[model samples]
Target: MKNSSRRRVRPASIASLRRVHSHGGTNNQKQRSLSTGRIGFFALLFVALYWVKLGFGGSLSTSSKAANSLGSSAPRRNRAHLSYDAEEQVAKHKLLPEEAQIIRTARSLSPVTYDKVAMSFFVMYGRFLLPFYERRPDMKVLNIGLGCEEDISARLLRKLLPKANLWEAEERVTCVGSEIEGLHSLTGDQGDVQVLDSWIEKSGGMFDVIIDDGKRHHNCQVLTSFEKLWPQLTPGGLYFFEDLHLGKSDDHRSYSTPACDGSSFVFSDHIKNWLDDIIYQGGYNSKKWELHYVFCQAGGCAVAKEPPGTIYNKPPSPNQFDKKQMLPGEYHFVTTAETFDPVTDKVTTHSFFTMYGRFLLPYYQRKPRMKMLEIGLGCDMNYGPGASVSLWKNLFPSAELWEAEYDGECVEKAVKEGKLDGLNPLVGDQGNNATLDSWIEKSGGQFDVVIDDGGHHNCQIKASFDKLWPQLLPGGLYFIEDISGKSKPEHLIDCVWPILCTHDLHHSGQVEGL
Candidate 1:
C-alpha cells in the first residue's frame, strides 16, 4: 500500500463492497449557487482573454515590446517588422513566426488562480496541443463555444496553426456555413451530437484537437459530447474539458440526472466516476479502446487517445490473433473441433487460447513455463471434456495449465480417454468459495494468467474472480469471457464496478496501456 505502483487486492470482502455516495443541495439552493458560479466564471474568462488581447504587458500596438519583456529566454522573433510576403500571409490569417512565439510565451507563463478559480487553459496548449500541431501541421481542430465577438481562444488557435482547419460550434453563432480564413462556423446547441456529426461528415475527416468550452454548467452535455465524439477524434488526438470551476461553485448539480441521495447530479464527482468506469471497461488489457494519457488541473482536464498498433511500422508478431488468417491457437482450435461441432452442436469456441490469444501470447512468450488457471473445462455433452485444455496445451506447450470443472465424472472420463493427459484437473463447484480456495492451493497460490470460460452465470463468475483475482501475480491478467450469457445487472453495478473502481482508485484514475 505504501508504494502505489503495486496493486494488491484483498478478495475476502469483495462481495460486500459499497460505493460511497457524494451529496449536494436542493434545487433552489443549487440554482442560486449556479448563478453566482456563472458570474465568477465569465469574470475570469474576461480577465484571461483581456490579458491575451492586450498582448500580456498591456497594449496590442506594443506587442513586440511586450514579447521582449518576457526576457531573452523567450523565443526570438521580430514582430513589428514584417516583409511584404509576411504581411500578406498575416492578412490571410496564416501563422507567422512572430505570432507563434507570442502564443508560446503566453502558454509558458505561470498559471494564475484566485479564490480556487484556475483560468489558464493555455497550460494544456503548451503541454499537449502545441506538440501535436507541430507534429501534424494540417491538423483539424474543433472548438465549441465561440465566446464574445472576438472568440480569442479560437482566434489564437487559428493564428497559431494557420494550415490547420478550425471548426467552431456555438448555439448563438448564426453563420453555419460561413468560412472565414481557416475557421469554419457551425451554429447549434453544443449538447447535440447530431449537429457536430453533420459537420464532421461534411468536413470529410476527424479532428486532431477538440475543446469543449460550451455548456459548462451541464455534466450530461459533457458526457454526451465525450461518448459520441471521442470515437470521431483521430488517435493521438487531444480532448480538453474546460471551466471545471463551475462544478466547484455550482454545487456540482446536473440539470438532468438526480444524484443518488435524491438531489441534483454532482457533475464533478459523477464524471470522474464515469471516467474511472471507462478505464476499467476498456483498459490496457482489452483490444479495443485505449486512453494513453490523462491529466487534470483545477480548471480543466485533458485526455489523449493512443494510436492503434496497425498504425505502427513494426512487423506483426507471428502469434498475433487474426480472424482473417489462421493463427497457431486458431489452427489448433479448428483441428480440435472434431470432439464437438462449433456450429451445429451450438458449442461456443470457449478455448482459452482462442478467446485470449492476443493478450496471452506476449506473457506466454516471456515466460514459457508460465502457470495458467481456467475456471471451466467445457465438460458438457455438447462441448466434450477437456476441449479447451487440448487447445491450450497445443498453443502453450510449456505452460503449467490447470482446468477446474464441476463434474468429477467428466474429468474421470477425459483422463480415461487420455484427452487430459499431462493436464492438472480440479473437479468441484466453481460457485463455492471453499472450492475456489482449494483450487488455488492445489494449483499453486499464484498464477500469471486466470481465465473464466466457465458456467457463464453471474454467481460463478463473481465467486471465481473474488477468490482468484487477488491471488494472481503482479502484472498478471484475469480474463472473464462469455459474460453476456448470465451476469446480473445488480452484480455488475454493485460487485464488479466496485472492485474495478477500488483497484483504479489506488491508481489515481489512470490506466497505463501496454
Candidate 2:
C-alpha cells in the first residue's frame, strides 16, 4: 500500500527534498511526515506570535521596518508630485524672488555653521514670536540697540510687522569702543536725546515695543530700562535687551584692555552694580512686572513690564548724556533740491526725499488705497522711495498722498514736474509748530500712514510728532527713519527718554481712559 501510494504521489520538488534531507530524515515516509508536522508547528507558532503581538499592540521588527520604508517613500512621493496651485500662489503674491533669496541666505548662515549659537537662538526666538506679534497691529515694539550694521531683529520686525510701528534706539559712542569697530560712524550726534525726546513728546504717543541693543554699559542699561524704557512702554508692550553678556564687569575690563587710546570708555563695573541693585532689591516692582530672565545660549534676555502705570510717566535720565551741538560737518550732506544724477539719471545719492518717494511707490502698489504722509519733506520727499513727487504719483495712483517739504524750491519743483498730483505739498518747517498745524489743517487731519523720514535731527522728529500724531487715525502707522543719532550717552539720557515717556503717557491714557 505504501509503495502504491508512493507511486501515486508526485515526486517531491528538488527544493522540498533538499529541505527534508537537511532536517536529517529517517526514511522517506518518516521524513515526509516529520517535515510536514514540523512545518505545521512552526507556522502555527508564527501565526500565534503575530496574533499576540497585534492584539497586545506590540510592534514587530518586520512591521517597524515596513513602516520605516513607508516613511522614506512619503518624501519621495511628495517630491515627485508638483502642486500647480502652490506655484500660482507664489507667483500671484510676487513672493518667489524675495522668499527664495531669504531662504538661500538663511541656509548659508544657518545656526550650525554660525559660531554665535546664543545669538542664533535668540534670533530664532524672535522669529518664533514675531508672527504672533504681527497679527496684532496695535501692538507696539521697541528695539534698544541697533546692533551691527545688519540688524537682524529690525529686519525681521520690518518684514513681519510692516504696518506695526517700531521704536528703535541705539547707543551712540563719541568714539567707537575697542570691542567693536565701525560703530562710531553709526553714532548719532551728541545731544540727540533731547531732540528724540522733543520729537516723541510732539508725536504724542508711546512705543509698544522697546529693545536695548546699545552699548553694554551697566549705568545705561539701568537708566534706560528703569527710567527711559519702562516708563515709555505701552501697557502689555515688550522690551528686549540684547547682548546682555556685555553687562558683565569681567568682560567689560577685558574689552577695555585692548584700547591704546583714551577714547575707550568701559562701564562694565557700573553695569554690574546697576543690574545687581535692581535684581536683588526688587528695584523694579515685582507685582507690576513679569520678569523673564532667559539665560539663553546667545546671551541673557530680560523682559519686563510695569504693573499698571500710565504711559505718561516722566522720562528717566539716561546715565550718559553728551551736550555737544551737532555741526553741519557732522551731517555728510544736506540737500534742499531733488536733483537727479547726470550719469545715472537717478536721484542724487544725497537726495533723501527722492529715495523715499521711490521706495514708497512699490509699497503703495502692494497696499493700495492706503493714505500716506511724508513729514519734513525738505526738498521733494527724499529720505525713502516715496520722497520724490513723481514717484509718489505713480506709486499710489488711487490714494491720497501728502508731502511736507520745508524748502520752497523742492516743493515748487515737485509741483512743476506734476509729481504732486494727489500729493498736497505743503510749505512748512517741521521745526515750527504753527507751520505744521497749518499744513495739517490744509490736509484735513487724517492720515493712515505717517513717515518722519524728515529731520534726522531729534527735536524735529519730536515737533513733527506733536503736530501730526493727533491726525493719525486709530490703528494708523507711523515711522521715524534715520534715528541712528541717539547713540550718544547724553542724548539717550536726556532727549530720547523724555519723548518716550510722553508717548507712554498718551498710549497709557488711550488704553485706559479711552
Per-prediction CA RMSD (Å):
19.5, 33.8
How does each model score on TM-score? 0.42, 0.30
What digit string (tens of lDDT, one per residue) describes model 2 on residues 1-514?
Answer: 0111111122232234325433211010001111221111111111111111111011222222222211211112121112122234334532222332333343343121121121322232332234225334555565545444455445544554566655554555433232322211223321244544643564344766555555443433334344434566665445554444444334332322212211233222223333222222221222333331111222333343432331222221221111111111111111111221111112232212222321232234334676888765445332322234443343346778887767777667656655455667777678577888787788887776677656544456566765676676533445554333323222232234223311111011111000
Backbone clashes in candidate 1 total 0
Which 10 residues in a row give candidate 1 its minimum summed lDDT? 23-32
Cα RMSD, model 2: 33.8
lDDT on C-alpha atoms for all candidate structures: 0.49, 0.37
Error of 2 at 351 (Å): 14
